[model samples]
Target: MIRLPENTTVFDDGEAVARAAAGHLRTLCEDAPNQRFAVCLSGGSTPKRLYTLLARPDYATLPWSRLHWFFGDDRAVPWDDPLSNVRMVREAFGTPSPIPETHLHPIPTADGPEAGARRYEATLKAFYGAETLDPARPLFDLVLLGLGEDGHIASLFPGKAALDETRAWAAAVPEAGMTPFVPRVTLTYPVLASARSVLFLVSGAGKQDPLARLSQGEDLPVGRIGGSPLWFVDRAAAGA
Candidate 1:
């Protein structure tokens, strides 16, 4: 497990988080060749700021067409529902909208959570194309995530079946203790560990305790990553 430094830059408010994502995305875009710069995103309030920041001119200059968006997880709710991650991302992409729906690879949540996860996993395989996502040799370019107050990332909540999943990279597991939505789609740790780069967006005082615990090597889902997780923390969330 890798440990985060005590004095990482604090995005003053959410601005810091936004700038961090923008810069990293611009760099990633520049690095990839003609192929798509595939990025799997977390569904949470944390990334909303980053997505909004990308709408600006500086961030907007990325090769949007050569980019593909995938979700780290999603509620079983309909796309139009308030609990929809798809809605959040599309809404965040206002104005010129960086990419079209053709580029957005949302998991099929409309097909009920369980079925949606299955369909989405198939889509993921297609996205990887020739590279193929193998649990033994995972190699995602970038996997962006958000820190849940309860230490969850993606749909891999504490004690969620997916947490113990060592087989499938993407799967649907029973959702209990979860709010209203039923089963959800998620990317397992084995797949996450294979990523070349992992970026986390954390904000709010509500997240500080988890951040502290995570930094102390707590066995939280987001902390047990096989690869490094570069956290973009905000001032209030980092604690004094």
Candidate 2:
């Protein structure tokens, strides 16, 4: 059987999970010594709650100005498209927030999936100041992730070509495994691995099967992620 990480936390529901994640993020930002922090954001209902919570007045003390936001992946669609992760994040974070325009780094989709992936990779390398990722100096201070029903993470579907990527920091997913079916631009495992902390936020009763399979050591996309992630799941998703 696969061993669960020691930091796994189960809450009563999705809302509770989001609240706990927000608290953890607040602490992470507050205790960080870095003059500037980089955060990789995930796209999902539960994560939207966390983003909304962070934008509220209660988290006003969070160092938003110094914190740079990056997307783990985005659909190859217009930024304003209803299915776009960028749109979801923008709506969740709300306007008139402390996050500066430059701090929010979105995956560019106008040039199509392949071009977008290349551009995003260059953007990350520029921010990291290196073409190669160094384990000693991680690229992101925190990476927030979500578990898909199909056991995917950051558009990295099981058995997809993106999973085999070792050199490129980003890749183009021509066809997604599930709904929306749009091509995607996603950060590869090598890039995601260079994170100080990774957290998986999983909820919904539909997620129980995947979580159970993971517990049984069934190989899946999310399992391949590099960092030792802390799973924050709801009771339903935890099968509790």
Candidate 3:
């Protein structure tokens, strides 16, 4: 485990982290002043539990009609593919969930990574009602993120060219640092930073090395995220 910042919260395990994240997310939705609220969802195993919990009674009652869902990143694959983040999220939400179909904004993967990224960028702009992002007016009410073992966030891998993106809200990764090396489209740091809140969920003993590196201030891609991120970590990841 690595040293955590003052804003970090340590949990007994991954389930505990998921529960806390769900509670915090619900609060964010309930407290939002706007009738329409946008939330950027995280991809990876860590968030599946949170999504499932949200589908359950305690959170299923949230104002799904007013909430808009967006993905932080997605592999360039068909929506129904087993490796597709969209598929994972859909299954986790379960059938007959209250979330509106039109409100779930997925990155279009029909035309490969580059085209998909461009299309997604347009979608985000349309939703944001502007081509350029304004710092004062965040694009999302909250952005959920996960820390990769290599210190990547979303699909922004460490030392990748995508990490340098500043102007574009979204970009394509021709190659990934890890397996399933398929192309991916991810929201850039600038876009990710334009959020009311950025939350990081870290779990498992396998995450210890990367967390340690982050704690030591290694300037990895995850560390480049703009806002003061809130971290939800399990004891195994925190080395508590």
Candidate 4:
């Protein structure tokens, strides 16, 4: 088996992982030098719990006004669809959240995955105020990611052409490797790497094989992520 990175953290279960992630997010926001903070969020059942935890009173009082939210990836579905990542996030936050409506940027899926990818790329560039990414500047303060059972991160499935994307900020996946099998729009590896930190939230026994592959140094899609990534996993997923 591949060795677990030094940055890996194992929890008793999914709930503990979520609590820790919520606390870390607050700290990152609090520590940012600039008033504005950009965070890229991942979509999955694991991260859903973290989002819900953040909505709690203890974590909800963070500087929501200064925080700008972006999605790392999104399925090509209407925002109101049951499978929509934006809808999941909105539901997790519940009503009357302090986070401003303008701060929450969701990938537009009404126009199809290819068009949606282009639109989201434009949105990221506009927010970053430049057509090209500057590694020194870093596009996001923190990017929260989730690892799929198939070893995919965000929507960058293994063997997908999107994994080869080196310059584009975003790209469209015409087909997904797993069920739901819907098209998707995702930030490219370059864009994901331009972050101060990338946190992978992994849970459930289903993730064990992927985690093992990662530990064995297999060049999976998740491994393509540049910079150091901290993986927060539960005992079951970690095989601890």
Candidate 5:
């Protein structure tokens, strides 16, 4: 419920953001050296730099073999489409992504939206079936998210029914309001709030207005995620 530039790390540029991300990854893996990192990755230009950095050899120092990667949200596009978050991650990572297939959880975009969402749910259940962990917690130790210009996080756009969804930690987005109308796959509010930590990676001049509105509790999707979330922003994005 509080926003403080001093609380979260602020990077001046994309390079700095990448370094911070790599450093965070290193620290997280250090604590659980033998355990897999159940991380949820964000998609967007803001995180593209981090993705490339992580896929590199230096960033690959982590026990990639034991890393588990999951997407926080995905567009309802075919697997090969440029908009596919899965493909973007696969492409960003060089030869060895350090993550094994058993750990990579990409949405089933190929089968179409409805089926894709259903299949992804099964995937999640299969992974944490007996853990007794709620749909949101522990799915990811750290969830990296990006704030949309409209204050939307993941596929939970402003005023969309998805924001009101309470059934599962993850849900299928079938509202045709979104331009593409492709089924979007995303983690629900409970799951988001359940995460051990949530980091909002926001860096862009176009985001100032929305960020201002969110700060005022304008009832945006991004505003709903109010558990003292950590934010990463550039000077320009902050309009400071």
Candidate 6:
């Protein structure tokens, strides 16, 4: 059985998890001290629901103008591909979404994973206005993450060299740990760690083992996340 961390918040179901995550995001945006709030989005069914909720009229008060959206990882496929995180996000938000076109920064993957990773890193550096990350100043206000059954966070899979990367803000995963098996570009740990808040949204019974391993003090990629990360999981994922 998984012994959930003290920071974990168990929800009744996946829908409740999405709702609570939406609320947490709203609070974070509202309370942000900076004029511009950056958010790193995660990809998954659970987060897709959260993104859809944010795009709805009910979340109109979320200050869309000041909030910038970014992706933590994406497959090296066309933006419109079904497996593409960019496609999923665009479809979830629907037409006439409040987020400005310039505000949604998708990882560039058309030029292949290597160049795409480099370009995306440049984009992030430009947005941060500095090449070097300062611990005192975070690159993002909130970062949303999902726990893979293999304990991978973003595209940094177990035993992958990307897990040891300490320089670049983003790195290319030429070979993924699992399907869709396409090449991917992912933000490195330092970039992810440079967020004011990191929230892991996990659901489904399949996630129980990973959570259990984390509880047992296994050094999964998720464990390397800084900033005192919090977990928001459904009962099934918590091994309830």
**Residues 51-135 of candidate 4: C-alpha lDDT, one tens digit per residue:** 8888888875788878999999999999999989999999998898667999999999999999999999999999999999887
The best candidate by lDDT is 6
Q: What is the lDDT, from 0 to 100, of the residue 12 in candidate 4?
A: 96
TM-score of each: 0.89, 0.96, 0.97, 0.97, 0.89, 0.97
lDDT of 1 by residue, 27-134 (tens): 777777686677777777768877877777876568887777888888777887777888898888785687866988887877776788678767777766633556
Pairs of colliding residues, candidate 3: none
Compose the digit string of candidate 6's lDDT tens values, residues 73-99. Answer: 999999999999999999999998789
Error of 6 at 8 (Å): 0.5
Weakest 10 consecutive residues of candidate 1 by summed lDDT: 1-10
Q: How close is candidate 5 to the true structure, as a TM-score?
A: 0.89
Query: Per-residue lDDT for 1-240 in model 2, tens only?
Result: 224446788899999999999998888887885568999999999999999988899988888889999999999999999999999999998988668999999999999999999999999999999989888999998899999999999999988999899999999999998998999998999888788889999888888878878878889988888557889988888777
**Runs with alpha carbons beyond 4 Å of true place in candidate 2:** 1-5
**For residues 1-240, could you state the per-residue lDDT of candidate 5 as single tens digits?**
224333467678656766786677778778876775677888888788888888777865777787778887798887789889988888887556656767788988776666776787677667766424564446667788887877788899876777888766577777633455667888777666666667788777777877788667687788777577777777667775
Local accuracy by lDDT, each model: 0.74, 0.90, 0.90, 0.89, 0.74, 0.91
RMSD values for the candidates in order, in angstroms, are 3.0, 1.6, 1.0, 1.2, 2.7, 1.1
lDDT of 6: 0.91
How much does candidate 3 score in TM-score? 0.97
The per-prediction tally of clashing pairs is 1, 0, 0, 2, 2, 0
lDDT of 1 at 208: 83
lDDT of 5 at 125: 69
Worst 10 residues of 4 by lDDT: 1-10
